[model samples]
Target: MTISTEQVQTAGRLWQEHRQAPFPDSLRRAEFGGTDVWVLDLYTAGCVLAWLDNDGILDAENGRILQSCIEDLARVIPEVNDPAGAQYCQQLHQLAVLISKNLASTK
Candidate 1:
């Protein structure tokens, strides 16, 4: 149940990439689409991972929060019509799942 060094490294990389991405203005709009929500969800999970990276720990509460974000994003992915957006969601989903698994093991 120990968190692996590789998991921590991967989380760090994902957090860096997430931080570098521009915030989507569509996220503020009331009429936002699946892609917009996807971006927002990714940001949420990235923030959780960032906390883990900074503190070198993932509590059960944050782990639960991360799991919720991942599940919510998964629901939105199928609603995304754009191929590029779908692919992006898929990639993020994979990373999020990995992080979630590692965090779960910590608990």
Candidate 2:
């Protein structure tokens, strides 16, 4: 998939925003939306941003994988007890939505 300049710019901006804070360390287990889920820490969110920035491109395969990760994170956002972690996850979710939209545009 060919990534647009806008997508690259958006990814960069998101990466910068994600890096502004230290990743949260607490892990909590809870059920959300009637499903058991593990709340993701800030590290996971950082990894997502890093993955996108590292590649500078989101192909079909990798985009799917990353999107799934973001979706999973979104599902458990309510479960995250740490305010920072929830914010990070919310940022990650936004990044994921951007990637998904870009991928769809390419298709």
Candidate 3:
């Protein structure tokens, strides 16, 4: 599979879905889709995508930054009241893995 710009755009949009939060509170546990939410899940997904965006998996430290970005998105998007939040999050994650593998194999 090819890593399309659409994938990157989607990932970027996901990150900026909720950009108005102050700071630390940007990634927190709250009710999403009427269920309990956790930033860790979103963080994991975002890190996966960021790894793909960078071409492949990071060594170590930068991977943490990717995770943080996802965490931040999770904290904020829910506040935007998107009902499909979880679904979009999962797609971004799967796309990230797909993109990483696709780009890595081509290298």
Candidate 4:
């Protein structure tokens, strides 16, 4: 199943509890723009979406590895202090995962 961008945005808005390590923290609060939140969500959503869209395009084994790579990349959440970059990094990581998954699930 594919999640729409709008839906993701809503989910992000609803989310209140700040995420912890390996989920996009940040080097500094100012860096991530107040505790690395939105960016993380964006990244996560992107990863999933990308996988769904690209996984199939890649070969079986290659696709799977790609998915795994994306997953790994998205795993590390910057530093708690670096909120400015943290959020963005998280979002970008998510996109990586999304793309990876999409590429790996092809028949």
Candidate 5:
């Protein structure tokens, strides 16, 4: 799926808005609307990271954040038990894998 320029801008806004907030304390038991919030957040963040990287806007700090997002998703994947949670986890994993490959190629 293509991320529009507006979506990339929104991702940048989201990153700046939340970068300094506390790491999600709720990750250990986070859920909402029958889905894992951490997974959802990571999916969005991962997309933003990829978009930023593609647009030549990703800095080292942002790269670290992206890596952290991937790690966070990996850490929580085993905890997800529901079908919806599993789907989100799978999507996140695929995003992370693709992003990692893309980043590697750009290096």
Candidate 6:
């Protein structure tokens, strides 16, 4: 499924607000889609969120990698369609948008 343009634009706005918040020094090694990766924290939440920004599999300019991040999060996050999972969805959406905007600026 494709992410709507609204999702990207809304996420872009949300990203601007939290762009400066530091990711804590605390981190751990984890696996994502069979690849070994370092993540911000042990919890799946942190790991999934970090995956959006760091995974090299995505091509930022084309937006496919950002799309992949969103798809991956949907699979990894439990009950993503449920009310409690809304926050995870929101974070994923924002990160995807941030990635998109950053890539666009470089072009």
lDDT of each: 0.61, 0.60, 0.47, 0.44, 0.56, 0.41
- Model 2 misplaced regions, further than 4 Å: 1-3, 28-56, 104-107
Residue 44 error, candidate 1, Å: 2.8
Give TM per candidate.
Answer: 0.65, 0.63, 0.32, 0.34, 0.51, 0.36
Candidate 1, poorest ten consecutive residues by summed lDDT: 26-35
TM-score of 5: 0.51
The best candidate by TM-score is 1
TM-score of 6: 0.36
User: What is the TM-score ranking, best to worst?
Assistant: 1, 2, 5, 6, 4, 3
Looking at model 1, the pairs that clash are none
Per-residue lDDT tens digits for candidate 2, residues 5-107, read 7777877787677677565555344445653333333434544554465545444556566666676877778777778767766876777676566552321
lDDT of 4 by residue, 1-107 (tens): 45456544443432322233344333323233243344435444444444334423444555555455445434445443456554655555554444553342255
lDDT of each residue in 1-107, candidate 5, tens digit only: 33457655654564565554444454446764454666557555655655565753444555666666676666666776765655555565555444444442232
Candidate 4 lDDT for residue 93: 57
Tens digits of per-residue lDDT, candidate 3, 6-91, equal 65555556455533222233224455445334544455555555554564535355455444544444554546444455455444
For residues 35-97, what per-residue lDDT tens digits would candidate 6 score against the true structure?
322231123233223433443123333355455555655544443334433453456455654
Tens-place lDDT digits, model 1, residues 1-107: 56667767777787667556554443333123433574456566654655566444566676666676678668766766666555555656777776766653343
- Model 5: CA > 4 A from native: 1-36, 39-57, 104-107
Query: Which pairs in model 2 have colliding backbones?
Result: none
Write the number of the candidate with greater TM-score, choosing between 2 and 4. 2
Using lDDT as the measure, the top candidate is: 1
Question: How well does model 2 score by local distance difference test?
Answer: 0.60
Residue 49 of model 1, lDDT score: 59
Better of 4 and 6 by lDDT: 4
